[model samples]
Target: MLSGAAAQDSAASATGATPVAGTAASALIGVSVDPSAVPDSTAGAESSGSARRELVSATGSATQPGGDAATATAAVVDGSGASAASAGAAVGARHSASTVGGDSVIPPDSHDTVVILLPEMPAMDAPGALEAAAEFFANPTWLPDLAGVRDCWLVTVGGEQVTSGDPVPHQFHGAVTAGFRCLGMESLGVSFRRVDLAAGQADASRAAALVRAVHVKNEPELALRDGAVYAKRLEIDAVQRGPARDADLAHVVIVGGTGTLGVEFCAHYARSGAGRITLLSRSGETAEVTRRLRPIRALGDTPIIVESCDVTDADAVVELAERQEIPATVLVHAGVNYVRAELAEVTPEKFREMAGSKIYGTEHMLHTWPRTPDCRIVLCSSAAATFGGRGQILYATVNRMLDVLARRLRAAGVDAVAVQWGLWDLEGPLHAVGTGPVQAAGVTPMRAADALAVGFTDHADHSGAENRLVAAADWSDVQALMVAIGQGPLLDDVVAAAAESAVVQPDSPGSGHRDGNSPRIAGTPADGHRGTADSAAYPSGPDRVRATVAQGGTKAMTQFRAAAGQPGAAGGNSANLAERVRRQLGRVMGADADALDPSVPLVALGLDSLQALDFRKRVQVELDRDLPVAAILGGASLDDVVRLMAGSQA
Candidate 1:
């Protein structure tokens, strides 16, 4: 088993420090040296479903090239390491001579470097890749093998594994890069080579040549044919701002086209003069397809076709792409399976389902692309990939893969980009479900037009760049959230630049802050009239009774009235309060406020228990009523709750 000192050494290596046998942290551990990749599309491991296991328990030693085999005993739990059982008794292959004390003996005519492809766990394997990852991290004995090597090339094959922030994946990448560095690999004149097998080009001769030709720079960077590796530093300040470019997207295809954001994209493209836009979704039913197409049809005479298609199905995607009359010049991957739940609530199947549309779907799309050149794929990733919000671990992981995939694609000479968007004002399928939680946190929602402009105009123009993180939020707020979630160090200079540009100009005409030089609409209105007062003008029904309560108004009133028992306005009394409750319920239930029958069970209006709880909390705070949590449980309706409040008052 690895000692605590070894863990400290691994951490120190990440920061370019020498690993001592037993030492407290004497040096700072830097952020991951190389970007990480997302987990592959393997079957859900049993360990992923259970509580996370410590990496130290999985520790085992690996054999060096010249040394006796230590018989590494740990099993692979994540994608970073291999299982000793599956790998057989043999360890790494022997090369040049080296000693445990960090001395080297190399012949005059040798390659001077060793390249190792990071192995992943097969889906059917036991103790899983995650377990293997734990074991690898626990000991990482092979790190000592690089003691005397001139250089080491750690080839990461899948793009998905390159930029992951999830704990297991992050630990695996750290163990490989920093773990090796701490083992005194650098002391032996070893330089690091991160060979990304872009677009599955490993079998191609050109790819092999590219790997052989890589040379490490004097700094902490690597190079391939003079082109620097793509990182946030390279493209962080590269967002193009101005009018939308007339992109030559004669034929554009959108996956997950039946959602609201899909239709919005179709509208934006139609306005941008896309020749023919085809939307693909799994639901082939006529009514569902028609509902999805309604907004697209509203966008004047552009030919918008709706077809039933599943992006996750490789054969179906290939067949559809093959049959397109005009070769698809652009493909937009907007497909996602959104599920927001706590870590403990997530099941292995749910994890797989969440990953299907983004991971498997993007992979299939890339593989099934027509051989025709100039074709580009644009993946719509989310900010969750970066900041990682509560109950969104799986969603964040999936989005992160999009960014990594773009990196791999570009490295492989493909025209691709992944745009990591913040919360958008236009409610897409994922947005519709996730907006509540996002707002509860403090991220400002980006406007629809601005969002489209950022994606199509800003990011699309920068074809050379791989990943673009686009979000309009206060730097302080974002920093606070990141700090709360333990991801502060990941924030780069780009975030600082964005934060500086987004400083609130109270004197500015519009309430929205400027991103760089361009002004973006802030989530809250400029006049500070975001609540019921502003909503009063846009009242939907004849009664005109439901105005949006300004944010925090309800909470303030609840505290005041609950503590002091002060009588409020007549409209705030129980009678009108009941009407307000019914109206809010109607909004949640997707029914007309004036037309809703207060006697009917809210469950009949599509509210489950959790949703009902959400509604109940809103009412309790808004009206300052001392309502029991279960008041809305069982067959309770608006009238039942109103009567209960009245009875409590008497």
Candidate 2:
């Protein structure tokens, strides 16, 4: 790694005025500063001295006995904690690969004060370089010169091994990482620095742009995520009456354009004055069903195109994108088949038929055509993905896959969103429209045209929601009509109302929970799902998706089955053997009967290996326990199987 060293003393300028031989700085390097000692933020948490220490010219400049100019600055804000925890990293957490070969990554920290390191930039850029240096000082860490200090350092890295290697041709930008180089020719021989921003979607994008600017300006090669690759456009969303002209306000597309959720999205975009809109479907006629949309065609000719396109045709999709300059800004995969069938009785053909339009369809869309960088994808998933509707296993599995596509696309510079939509009015699609299940569920299913119009046009409020569930069919209407836009005028109230009714149990054990590996409720919760406490709402809250047929996708791949069947690692956890059986029966059956002991016989708790295996999988998803899949399936009684799965890992 290229490194830099320099001697400049301004550390005390911002805190201790001028250090007296008797006074010491609060935190030498952060670990032990008593917060109460110092009154100001600079003096930091606190110190153990009487006289106020002031800044002094304390830097010692070292000329390179040789050379390396990678300036490294490390600053930390220490919180009062146990000595063991404060001194260094947590004991076991810093292992190079707790999960095996991957490098140890640091979790986001609250006490991370900014640290700025400036190297003696090469000459010739003069004005720009000085400006860069001044801006770089914005770091909260360093005590600034204006706050009172003197000249800085002309230093070079010391005490490091030197390597002699081949000389290569000069590129426009300096080497970004070891193997990569920034191809920008103008960035060579310049200086740069990175900055932090408020923690939110808007600000994060801004910060990313700032860092990218420096890399591009300096013509230096940068680490992948550290540069332009992370660009995220923030559009104006005309519905919002803000001065900002963000990129998010650009064009957006809805796939299942005629469905309940699809229309709502349209309304939001229309109300927000999204610059343009497109509703994609298997047929163009589906787009012409709504009357209010006739005016949308003119909106000063904003171009709300209704195109006939089969999602399954990957080649045609690529053609559609190449034909349009703006690209499909937001594509939702809401087109799905909601079939009901028990796990034991379902036929393979039925699974294929229902899922073909979405699974194979979406795969064709993403893999064959891919998406534009600025586009945002919204795939409509279902609660069944989490609730495990016995008859809808195949359907749920397909939906679960969509929810997770976001992370997979993130690294590639695209965003994917899988939203678990509640069932629309029965008549809306799958179930017969007027059915009791649809009626009791209280869902207002918009017609195919209404769904497309609403989802494509509305720019309603997003605040006050806890789980991103949208219930008020009011916005559904507004969306279809392209009426009442703004940063959601009565947004909070509406969101609060919708949230109150939608939540199952705001305080239940499974409510408002989050797991890093699971996308069931991931990303920046949707505009409707304001991530907050779902208090006083339905007490049960949506049943924890954790108890579903699937939650962790790659974590429980089919390969795990083959791995266990192969050899030694297959032995089940001994501690789990007894305890699991009791829990499985009690939990799965919703049996509040009595306190069952782990030692109880399989018959007593309700045995059967098939059920046991199913129970074990649910256990792993709900609680991060790993039980051999076979342990419960191979004739092991409930108690025996539970014992195997419930080992200490449970």
Candidate 3:
């Protein structure tokens, strides 16, 4: 967080605004300035003009006024050249003031514009900083005349730092900027640009040119790097390369050592000839912790120490590091407090707790650990950081922060690597939520051993990279999901590989059968079902749909379709079709068919992506018609889906 004076100066420099003698121009342009920072002579200047008086007198106190503050602020500027402090004070004073005559003051010109410049802040401060920024810019009291403001520029600093491998966190900044851009465009009808200025290079001409480029191109994110402005784009490369040899693991320290992944890491390192292993966790030496660590202890005769320490606490980490007689050669920061909830549903407290466990824990561990070029730091991040999963925004953000931290450490000559791992086939958070949604996204859950092996090998040689994504994925399913989400271009190579492999192996598992009935899509079961001899023994019609839905996936669809002579057996009548659809959906969602609301989207009733694919397949098989994957997962209600199915039968 920048000091008030520094923030004002930085904002002014970035916007090419010449600062007044006593009043900062940046404050007028929307960067927050401390009232105390203003000179007494300038602060004492009475706000002049009808616009200023109306704005100040409209609200009697320093509280948010009910209407368009932006228009009112613009009117003040139009009416008189009142200093920023005076304007701010007048606006601040209006919080308690009521309308002078109960008629809202109208600005002389609605075209008046306001430019908001957000100063540089640490990456961890992004969430709170953005919230504060949003409140300031969008607040009714601050901008009662919101219509007057047409453009918003969030001035973010750190383009050079990111390129130079400095630890300046930009992922969170980008995410927050994206959110604000959407909000500004949709809610405020404001054109928003996240302008990144390089450090020590915020000249007026460069800043002006960058802003012009961004405005002209309508780019949401633009960065000034090495005096050249560039638009930020996300791209993915699918490269096939052999893994590097595993690194030596002699003396190791595992944070969050009692957690599932932590224990797995300890066991793997122990097996890999780690001489001494120290486990740090808040749980300390509880019976549960001991039970979890017993197997790892038996893995080898490695000396293991279990200690209670919260990695989030700086003092605890420093004390532990100082107390250790034998310094660790490798530090594995695997700490994470998982919370699964939609972005809107996540409470600030929950976000803090989750972020604290990883972000703060990593900072504390890194800063306190003895720094040596020979030492290795392994940050256990998740695939969510790379490919965001549903209800894991905060999870992804923190993991991304770790990735940045690893790069920063690596740039500082430390052997640090961040491993963005996929879902492990273990009883962890994903399992608790039912891994159907993630599996539907085409990520195959890797066994812990396999995951560790890949991670260790891939990250062993990080001379060219600080982060590596290691996960088992079904490329075909992955490609389908990416295409559905309009990000097919990112995985062009993966799609090509999937197509090439299909041509090479026509009879591959999960591939479409010789019959044209089975269309290859996401969430297909690994094994394709072959027709049974006793076809007549199977159920038919709505009963068949219900049975197949309960059975789950493409295999169920295949078996039921083969049994029901003609797949359209269930399409006898509209009422029968509706009932079958409801029952089938209910079965997949573990809900009661009678209780399910037909007007609600399937996703609202807990139908995840994978289940949606399965449900679509079942419907196609039962009704003998094709169902687009989008109709099921794209928030189409039950009634809408039923109508589509009925129309397809016609």
Question: Per-residue lDDT for 1-650 in model 2, tens only?
Answer: 11111000001000000111211101000011001112223322112211121111112122222223232222211111212221122112222211111122223331111112222123211123223322322221222211111111111111011111111101101110100110000111111122111111112223322222222211111111212121111110102111123446566676766554455556556655677777777766443445646654444545566777787677777677667666555566667566654433345555555556666667666654434666666666654442222245445545544443432343245655444444454344566422333212212332332122222211111211001122212221111111111111112222222222222222345433332311121122223222221211212334312111111222333223333343322345544434443465677556652465445544345533234434544554444444443333222445564445444333
User: Model 3: residues >4 Å from true position, as ranges?
Assistant: 1-248, 286-295, 460-465, 475-489, 502-611, 616-650
Task: Report the number of backbone clashes for model 1.
Answer: 24
Model 3 Cα lDDT, one tens digit per residue, 1-650 = 01111111010000011111211111000011111111224222111100110111112221222323232222222121212333343234433211111133445345333333333445444335334333332332322244544444455555223232233444444344433332331222344445566554443434333323333223334454443444332211111112333555567888987778888888877866788888899978888878877887888799888999988889988888888887767888877567765534546555566677677677777778664557788888776654555566556655656665665565567777777777776777668768777766555565564355445532333233335555545433443344333223333422332222211012344332233322112121112211111111121222211000001122323333433444533536778878877877777677888999999877678776567655654555555544444455555789988787666455
Please give the distance, in angstroms, between residue 409's alpha carbon in candidate 3 and its true position after superposition.
2.0
Residue-level lDDT for 572 in candidate 3:
62
Highest lDDT among the candidates is held by which one? 3
Please state every model's RMSD to the true fold in angstroms. 20.3, 24.0, 18.6
Ranking by TM-score: 3, 1, 2
Prediction 2 global C-alpha lDDT = 0.32
Mind giving the per-residue lDDT tens digits that candidate 1 earns over 127-215? 13223433443433333343334445554433223222221222233223322222221121344434333323333333323332333
Q: For each candidate, give its TM-score against the true structure.
A: 0.47, 0.34, 0.55
> Which regions of candidate 2 deviate over 4 angstroms?
1-247, 286-292, 295-301, 368-371, 411-413, 433-435, 438-650
The weakest ten consecutive residues by lDDT in model 1 span 7-16
Leading candidate by TM-score: 3
Q: Evaluate residue 274 in candidate 1 and report its C-alpha lDDT on the 0 to 100 scale.
A: 80
Q: Which stretches of candidate 1 lie over 4 Å from their true place?
A: 1-238, 241-246, 285-300, 341-347, 369-371, 428-434, 492-650
